[model samples]
Target: MQLLRSIGFFHGNILLFCVTTGAGIFVSPKGVLKYSSLNIAVSLSIWAACAVLTIISALSLAELGTTFPRSGAPYYFLKRSLGSSVAFLSLWIKFFIYPLGIATQSLIISTYIIQPFYTRCPAPELPKKCLALAILWSLGLLNTRGVLTVAWFQTISVLMKITILCFISLTGIVLLGTGKKENVAKFENSFDAELPGASQIAEALLQGLFAYSGTSILINIAGEIKNPGENIPKALITVLPMVAVVYILVNISYLAVLTPQEIISADAVAVTWMDKVRLPFIFGSIAISLFLILTPMIHSPKVEYIYGFIFIFSGLLGYRLHVHLNQRSVCFDKITCYLQLLFNVSPPEDQDEGISTGKKHLEEIFL
Candidate 1:
């Protein structure tokens, strides 16, 4: 059965907003800071650069979604332009990655919730994992209920998260106005520090991009939107920029209140921000209520990237071999083209040469 187009531009806004502005904002500053050599100027520039990249990526995906007008997501595109085996391999890798993603998010959320309780020490792995599992089950059940239900839940949760972020941003502004200028603004010597290596710059960009990684969320569900042509681009173009702005403001707040070294040292930047602001003890309770996130499986920061790189490299190699082995048919008229391609079957009626635009199709993973 096909999905109902219950998701209008309004709901699309929520899903896209919530998907991109996830917990990576609060925790990922740590990774970005370390990689950017703890220079406030370099870090903010990286954040802005990542935001631009995300916007470009989202716009490109919007074009693809409208052109295809299908909910088949990446697999559909790959199969049509590339071939079926490549698409199958994408699905195969996702089977494992999705669960890993869920667990990672749950772990990060649980870590933030549990950290406040252990003020003197890091929370134990047992409790964090247990809480994460509970959260995982709850999310699994939530998904089973329906898309609308999840959308409503996301709407409510995202509002609270935004409120908290605004409050933090305001606090930073107040601090700046009250002569906390040193911490509030530190751009004078931003790039004067020794430059980070190429790898470090790349890693910093990766960490910053994670906060905006859900650019494809709407595209993946394009068929469920009321009018993919108008609504998809409208939502992505409008929502992602606002998310990027909020993230930059929140990071400014983070920098305003905490020293570079302190930000680097903190495990959960949001929790630390709360403590620095001297918010009531109840703030911790509230944060646990408002926040949910994902962390890497191995816990160390770099290990997660390593695992991701390995999987991505494997997938690319497999795709190359698969595409090489299964060369697409020279002609597809009166033939079922690439269900194997998507819901389309070329009928030898049009002037379009192929689903793939050229004699030699180059693989370009833009995002």
Candidate 2:
């Protein structure tokens, strides 16, 4: 069974960059500002600190990923280093967490999409949930085609997102140079304001960390990446710092255009920045939609984890019941097939051989 190694170093790096520096940049600046007692400098500092910490974590995980280079990275790492139960638990937790993240991002996208249309009345909740499911299933199906399709989609979307950010940052820089004294004065005064408490600072850092959370995504699809050993680490090191820089610059852009108080009060900081700059509503909505789309697409590879966990758990339960009833055996071919699908590998030429191999592995752990 051969998996496609279609994702090159460039695509891998861009994917990691997009995933780690997500829609959080659009919303988190406001949260950090508000929670850190409206201190713009402290919020930006926390963002930088978290980016560094995230880079360190990415480096460590890159070593592990390149060494093992498996499709289900966390599962393989834990299974070999600890045991099967720990690996299984990790998959189980990821099953819930990843989908929840996708759903949350989808809902956010739906809200932003409907915001302009529903200005006269409250947007309906059912349509939002429906749109979320639609987006989830559509992306899941797109991923099932092959790794190449997913990689290309991620690369294009990420490039577009970065361009939008660059535009926003440049707009801020231009505005700053042209006598935007009101917000500049407020931003300058903020540097001398009282600093936030340690707990408040910690909370702000956590928010930044959450924004930088997807740096390890390359590891999840290690088997499908071209030259995993070289590309995995290269992508991580290349993208993490770059993403950190983008985050900091974007936050500065937000502060440059709007005062700290304006940012803290903004429901969506990027949109607010756009409004402050008097950009058209259509362009703002497009940027917001792109951010929403890119955020969930970061988790696209994890869709397999959901199916993998279900099949493994069911197989284990069937095995237990067979043992209790003293039956001859519980079939394990289904488990083998599901695992191959989960890893996006073709089935072996000999089905019996594949099932026997899988059954032996499970028997060692469960029997």
Candidate 3:
């Protein structure tokens, strides 16, 4: 398969970072409160673990992508390794997961945009569905036109969000140090050693886990990568540590600016904190909205056009690694020999004769 020579390492990694940190500014405080009851160490530990898991998963996938270099990553991996049933099931999950996640974030972004105009609009009847559909379909059209455009949009959005976060973090920390008469009790209480209840721990962990959800976007573009093995893994590794640091620092800033109870009391912490500091509620809402919707949309092409490429790449790599770790199987050798003969040769090998021919034909329809 031929990849468009548009996106390079910087563009790809920027998108990955944005996707990895998408919407966390809005949801993370509530998650942290639930788990550790304001215990900074526990909350930080949970976040660190999640970041590590994302990195490790990406590393394993890196090896797979290097060896296989196929499209439809997850789909390819499962299908080749397990069988058709598992492969299809995995693809089905991918189909639902990405679209639904995008739709849900879109609705939230629309709400933020709408809130400024219609402060009196009832929460239950925000009419965000229509707005979400518009954004979703618009982005869909953009992606269908070309993925490079999507990557550029993602990079810009990410820069915008980072600027907002840095501004908020810096101002909040400075304000706190000035001995302002704000409620600093709850944030200071995070150092207390009272353990949280089991339910609270579960809820907080779940929320933190969501922060790591989009790390797989790296896998989506595996086939198009300049060097799938090195580039993909390197991007993931770089993004994870950066995300972890940003998350921890942002939370600290929130704690410094407003008490923990204040963050938890509001429906959206980032906006509420911004509003507390005399920032316009409208501006805060808009910033938060863009962070959620814009970041995730950057990774949609993989979900839409080449859904399973990363998985396929990963699976092939896994098979190769398995052979390296253990003795090579005769079955594996025979399958590869037959696949090479049919797919790479002129008189396609029996089973390969039809499948390889069919795949080439299908590519024409999509490309």
Candidate 4:
């Protein structure tokens, strides 16, 4: 039986937008501001550059999606275009790395969602973890219903996010117009802050790049995308720039209302912005689970080489693990699913033929 291409442009747009706009938009403005050495001009420039890269990445992924027309996102494409080893590495990352991010985002949402009750000290971990688990389980149940069900939820969520972000932006613009230009009062002196060194700039760029992190997520479900050639590009072209503009405008609003010091100090930049204006709003988030991926950049200087080595190591590690496992007849995916169950991570799904190909290469190389 074949899968239906039920995910049309509308759903695709939601997926792209919602995945790409995560807690980063709310939180990373501070990182962007901080890493850029508190320079507003440098901060905005980093954002603009990231926005352009987002477009480029989406367009490139569209070409690849249409060309491969495969499900399992990078898993299949990397196998076919590059090799099984590379694809196998992505499978490992999907299983291992993604779940950390998922948990982080969930906790962020839980924190913000429960913040109202505490209103003073931090929310206790027990309640926060319970709420996060409830949220994760609820979404897990929703996913079992099918793609469209998930898409519809994303649609509602995306609309709420856009609305709040727009509210923030418009409010900032109004403040600027009304002469409450706290950060941008003197536009001429905006660039007066000294630029940081290369390491700091690179760190700032990473912060900015991650701001557009999940745009490539559509490729994960590329096979489900209706008319991959047309709809993929259309959805990306339609949504990303709009997100980019929102990000910039929101940043401007933050600068307009809150000073750079406040931006850097706040726990959540958006939350702080809202608090400053006394805008009573707190919406549930599914995207805050995506920010944990930023940790490696902060911890390592040789990140590029580290990433390359990890992929190579994953291929070798996968091969060795598969060889030792007694279930020679079972596919690698079934084993992955078992691991998922144990970890409370993304539970395994039925995979396509491409997944088997990863292990097949190891079989050929060994036997």
Top-TM-score candidate index: 1
Q: Which runs in model 1 stand beyond 4 Å of their true positions?
A: 279-367
Question: How well is each residue in 1-367 modelled by candidate 1, as lDDT tens digits?
Answer: 9888788888889988887777788788988989988888888889999999999988987888898777866778899888999999989998998677667767888989999998767889999999999998898899898888889998998898888878888887777777755764564667787678899999999999977877798888877888899999999889888888888888888988888788889878888888887764477667765553223334545666777779999988866765777744444422333333466444444437553542233222111
Candidate 3: list runs displaced more than 4 Å. 38-41, 117-124, 179-189, 279-367
Evaluated against the true structure, the overall lDDT of model 2 is: 0.77
Q: Write the per-residue lDDT of candidate 2 for residues 23-104, one digit (tens) a residue.
A: 6777678778876787777887888898889988888988777888878787899999999999999999999998876676
C-alpha RMSD (angstroms) for model 2:
26.4
lDDT of model 3, residue 184: 54
Name the candidate that leads on lDDT: 1
Pull out the clashing pairs in model 2: none
State TM-scores per candidate.
0.74, 0.71, 0.69, 0.73
Whole-model lDDT, model 3: 0.71
lDDT of 2 at 185: 73
Residues 154-239, candidate 4, lDDT per residue (tens digit)?
A: 99999999888899999888887877445457455877878988998889878888778788777778878888888888888899
- Candidate 3, number of clashes: 13
Residue by residue across 92-211, what tens digits does model 3's lDDT show?
897898888888677767766565544333344446788888998998898897777888889888998788777776776676677755535544545566777778777777778776
Q: Is candidate 1 or candidate 2 better by lDDT?
A: 1
